[model samples]
Target: MNDSRSRWLALAVLALAQFMVVLDVTIVNVALPAIQTDLGFSAEGLQWVVNSYTLTFGGLLLLGGRMSDILGRRRLFLIGLGLFAAASLAGGFATSEGSLIAIRAIQGIGGALLSPAALALLTVIFPAGRDRNIALGVWGALAGIGGTLGVVAGGVLVDGLGWEWIFFVNVPFAVVAILAAPAFITESRRVQGEHSNFDVAGAILGTAGLFALVGAVIRTEAAGWGSTQVLALFGSAVVLIGAFLFVEARAKDPLVPLRLFRVRGLSVSAIALALNGGAFLGMFFLTALYLQQVHGDSALEAGTHFLPMGGAAILSAVIGAQLVTRFGTRAAYLGGSAVGAVGLLLLSQAGADATFAGGLLPGLIVFGLGLPLVGVANQIAAVAEVPHEDAGAASGVITTAFQVGGALGLALISTTATTRTGDLLAAGAVQTDALAGGFERGMLIAAGLAVANLVIGAVRAPRIRPDAAMVAEASAA
Candidate 1:
């Protein structure tokens, strides 16, 4: 009933909601084989099970954030949570590939609403100081661990229960969060202001443009970058985004105020987080491939290997909070990025004959440790200096940056690795050797991206004032 206990409880609910959303991002990967067997999905068609959710989630995030600012955060959070739970329940019973994909898309819509609203709530709930930094560290840790845990959980569920249990599992967590949310979390929106009309045109253009952009990026995995469909989508995205920017400049009220970009912390953090996300996801993708295809690990075995990663990230998050508290976000982020680059470089040394302990484990532990450091610092930096009214929009940009960047990075890494494998195969290499070589190349590319993150952090990162910005009213309703 007291303010302090209530805020922490509210965080627990929000973190649970966010963890569920993040879990869905990767939980379905391990279940894909089971899903294909049951639903008779074509190899190509099955990829959409993952792509549909990511693209839709990435595309609609900005709109969701703006809507949160217009509507209430608590209201949007509850609505999104309800939609997500219902879709997950429906997805468990899907008899056809089409039905499952559609449900996943709906889940993505829920995520777009829920993710930003939840993050914005954190920004508003914890004032700028040590408490907010600690809160964000917990958030970053859970988010990082969620991806790893998804694989572990998916493997266990798919092997123990049916694949449907993966979807079924979300229902109980969502129900608990939905029930507990209103008791602790309070409704808040952008303070009442003049020119309150929503920017419908900006919403349409911006959402459509982001949708097209993410679509083009996703298509690049199957269709080459130069393919007609990919090019057309890219062109459409460019024009629509250009139009959206033009409209926002002149609109009485913008869906996302252009001025928000001027916030040094938010802008720099978005870019840095994008690069960090790229490296992080690329590492995970390549490692998964290396473990399964190269080392002959089963899905469940590979998932278990990632448990160390989750553990390392938890410890790193605690250290990251201290680093941010003592030094600042910039110092912590730069340090983390450097460590991540080193981790990726170590992973690049893995060979066809590599043993898990000798080759893979060290890199996995190091990368995991560095990941949450970058994550926690960016989480704080992104919103620490943002105005109260635009907290939702700021959260949206940060998350969209990470998601879209991961998509782009994965595409690039996959292509590079595939091309390298093809080249090695042509040169008379064995299948496993070629696969290992390809994975090595991919890890190297990820390392390069991590190094790029370090450069961005060192050069462009904002020096955040710990006690300024991000304080907002948190009165209980």
Candidate 2:
């Protein structure tokens, strides 16, 4: 058990934990109908099963990251794993919709703690260079693959073993990760004298603001954007967020250091990551609907259909790391975004008459191919120049962007599709045809968002050679 071997083993454990976290995000999606039917969930209430997780996960991410820094990455990681595992078990046994949603929210809190801690641990363990780059590539690929695989696995599990299996499935992975983690992950925390107290007000304000914001976004489709409830949530979010910023600017030990945004790479990459998430995640949600609703595929069939997309994402992630190594982050971001947008455009043309090969496969493959390029590049850029002590916070910001973006993206795209479907149905179109029309329109919006990512990356992301001092440091290690 030499140092190098130990680090690699730790990476494996961390990645496994991450895969579970990512998997849960979309795994429950395919099981939605089943869960709803079994529990007698209202159409509106059904969305909460997913939204509860996203809101809590997104809201607590910064605090989790900060806790990892102040408390100890390994300690927070274990605690998170334990909590998540317990919640999953409870969810499996839940007989009521309220109980399930509560359990899911608890799971999100665990995820918020685990995800950033795992990423920060990786950044701590792997020195910057080819090793770190490769590790991040694998992590990014898993992020993409996990979401897609969730859809596939969800369908299989729900159809074969029932929807409860979705939660039950996480138990084994959590147990393994909890047992293996202590052996491989060494404890690391910020210097003791750096900060005397945590920024409690900032944490409360930020978390509450984010939760409100995401809740508002989630309700927009059902309540209408201008509804009183939605408007109140939005106003509260703005005020709370503004107050959080004010607190951060004045706090002695800020939850999120305001100065971190001074790093060009971190700021730009965060924005790009958000936009990329909006498009990529939105694509997944809409495509799944198109396959199941429009194409009339069963859960298993729909899951199987996503296999190519998952495979492509994994393959492209490997290549994406190399692209970043050779051409730099800017080039990789630009190239990936351009290609991904094109893929979405192709998907936007899908209709009722379109076949799998003729309609969906091409875009699925292309979108999958392009995802990792952006994903890996954005990841590298986000943490490339971060100070070691703030790695956890940085990781939190990145993860938060992805979670919040996914929620917002799904809400907007789903709304677009729903509205379009209503119009088509009003015009006397068949159900399948109306759904296809809605999906196509939604895909087009997703494509535009991807293009926006390309523009942002080109304008703001700095070009840094992979062989710079960071890689040199890893090579020396």
Candidate number achieving the greatest TM-score relative to the actual structure: 2
| For model 1, the run of ten residues with the poorest summed lDDT | 468-477
Taking the tens digit of each residue's C-alpha lDDT, what string does model 2 give over 268-385? 8778877787787678767766787788887778888888888888788767766788898889889999999999999999999899999999999999898777766776677778
| Candidate number of the best lDDT | 2
Q: Which ranges in model 1 have alpha carbons more than 4 Å from their true place?
A: 1-12, 32-48, 94-99, 119-141, 179-204, 217-223, 383-392, 422-431, 464-477
Q: Tens digit of lDDT per residue, candidate 1, span 135-195?
A: 7756765666787789899878887888899999999999999999999988888787733
Global lDDT scores for all candidate models: 0.79, 0.81
Deviation in Å, model 1, residue 76 alpha carbon: 2.2
Give the lDDT of residue 427 in candidate 1: 100
